[model samples]
Target: MAQPKYRTHVGMVDILPGEVEKWQAVERIIHEEAKKFNFEEIRTPILEQTELIARGIGQLTDIVSKEMFAFERGDDQYVLRPECTAPVVRAFVGHHLEQRGGTQNLYYIGPMFRAEKPQKGRQRQFHQFGAEILGSDDPIADVECMAFMISVYDRVGISNMSLKINSVGDPESREAYKQALIDYFTPHKDELSEVSQNRLEKNPLRILDSKEEEDQPFIEDAPVIGDFLNEESSQHYAKVKQYLNELGISYEEDPHLVRGLDYYTRTAFELISPDLGAQDALAGGGRYDLLVEEVGGQPTPAVGFAAGIERLLLACKEMDIELSEPKSVDLYIVTIGDKARSWAIQQLPEFRKKGFSATMDYAGRSIKSQMKDADRENARYTIIVGENELNEGKFTFRDMEASEENQLPLDEIYGRLKKKL
Candidate 1:
């Protein structure tokens, strides 16, 4: 037989049992925080119509241009979703959810696909937890999103983070800035990396985000977006900063933070930590005000942010945050005789139904071996059922943690454990 051609590769991962608890605890915190902030959960298809992403997310962006996993199905082509906002906007329009003229706060936690060279805390397929607030352009809304993100990090015990923000400006100002960027890079065109050189012609703003060592010096000297911000964009950015100040949220204005998405219009921001090597962004998001209108919804204004779960988990490990302890077994049934074994088996379901994490010696080992196994599993209570005890309808209950033992009738065992547990 031929071996399978595609085995698990470097960029993929399988979450094992020992690590699953941390993942679950993180997810629980996300949900709890989202609920506290009044954001409703929304699920979008993992596979989206290709054009939805190509148009909604921007064809010039790396995610749409190079990272997407595209395939054909019947008459239509589809791509695995690379981000959450685009599909959520599609759903908002298709469902006419805002016809009532109200607002929607949506949150999603799921896997996002991107075909990038894997590194520390990054994978080909990674999961992101995100929240989007649509239908409001209030600068306070932007601050709220930022605050919520910080709160989530705090809840997860991640500290030593710096918040960096920038205003990408509305389409009008962005185009003007894009022209300036082109003119600035035009003279240094030959010095730019091949990837950046290509970006210069398509989306010059993306050149600022280039990671190539060769592009750094040139990108640093390029025109700052803050200098070119028009009146409306300037005021919007100022108000956002003012709100952050009011909330006592410390932030640094980074003119270079053009988030890697075409949909972003104004107010792009990232939460960074020095602990993460090259890719230090623990969470990132920004305003995509024109996205709804760009994608055929009524001029809806939106802002949102996303944090990588794996990266956040790494941060927890680096910061030494403890995850919730594993569940403890309440009881282990140890049987010494065939009749006692039969009786123990009969009593197992009732013990479980009474809300106890119970186990029994399925190996039918000696009582000594069973006791050792029970200790290894950290069973809180051990019930010994030998021939004499079974004949008397009584059992020996030993407390592993307290190191105490008691005698109990089979009929009273459930009630006694209920009180003790």
Candidate 2:
């Protein structure tokens, strides 16, 4: 019988070198944009207490009830993070990050796990890069967060994208709207999808964002949250829109843009690209003022967004945007004979120490074969060391691109390559 070949787990992918380069390019833009906005990077664990996510993301949401990868270990129940915001908040409160009492601007880039069925641009094990600003409820914070997110997408050269904004309103107003959604959805109970019907009783706002074909007609006619916003929430939403307008940023108002998570309160937004069909969102987030207190921190207001790295890359591919390729080695050293091979081994570190990417043959291949490898790697220069050259204290340097060769003394080789590089 033949043995089974190993394969990558379903919904999980191995990011090989060529594809990883594109991911790195996107991450570079994220880091650069985050730095420009004065947001520091923060890394949190992938695993957290199950209760944290259940409470933070809400028991009623699909992420907490249906998607989370959770299990019990001994006496403790833990879960792989389905999203970043809840874990970020857990870290913030657990570490007492708010002890200083000022706004905390933090960013993260890492893998997030969920158990959802995979589709184009959606996966169970995926990556997210996002920012969270804790301790500020001011409308300017919301505006700046959106601006920073848009700037990242702009820097990445992704086009044909649109920003949709909405305000779910404060807790009081949100509750009133929830009741309104219940009233509207209850009439169409038998027509609602099984998933949406469950959400109708648990969290009716989620039904508005549902992808169910059967529920769209009813959701389209449902009452808009904007109509029910309280005075303060309404003014806050207006100021956010005004700031976006003054910044020359264009956006469309989306009354049904309630985010997937239950913690979000006011200022919900999503950036969608036409390239991704069906699952069109490239990134989304909103204000979550009550989450901090729910997770055992003091009442702190915050807003932020997270973009899927894979989805962003997908958009780039659809638009034919070229990402940066990794640079090749500066030199490939080819050696002949025992003395030359030993010398090449010793000199390899010297070349690298001077900031040159240098590689040499370790498989004891022929000089001709090593030269072929050098060409395949696109090495700029190839150094040939032989018995004669070792005895003469000189080396032969060939410029691969120009097809030029020079015989330089051992000490002069470094200077010559440094100048060329």
Q: Model 2 residue 201 lDDT? A: 80
Residue 69 in candidate 1, Cα distance off native in Å: 1.4
lDDT of 2 at 382: 87
- TM-score list, all predictions: 0.93, 0.97
> In model 2, which runs have C-alpha deviations exceeding 4 angstroms?
1-4
The residue-by-residue lDDT of candidate 2 on 167-214, one tens digit each, is 998888888999988988887899899989898889888888788799
lDDT of 1 by residue, 343-394 (tens): 8889889888878889999998988899999988879899998899977877
Model 2 clash tally? Answer: 0
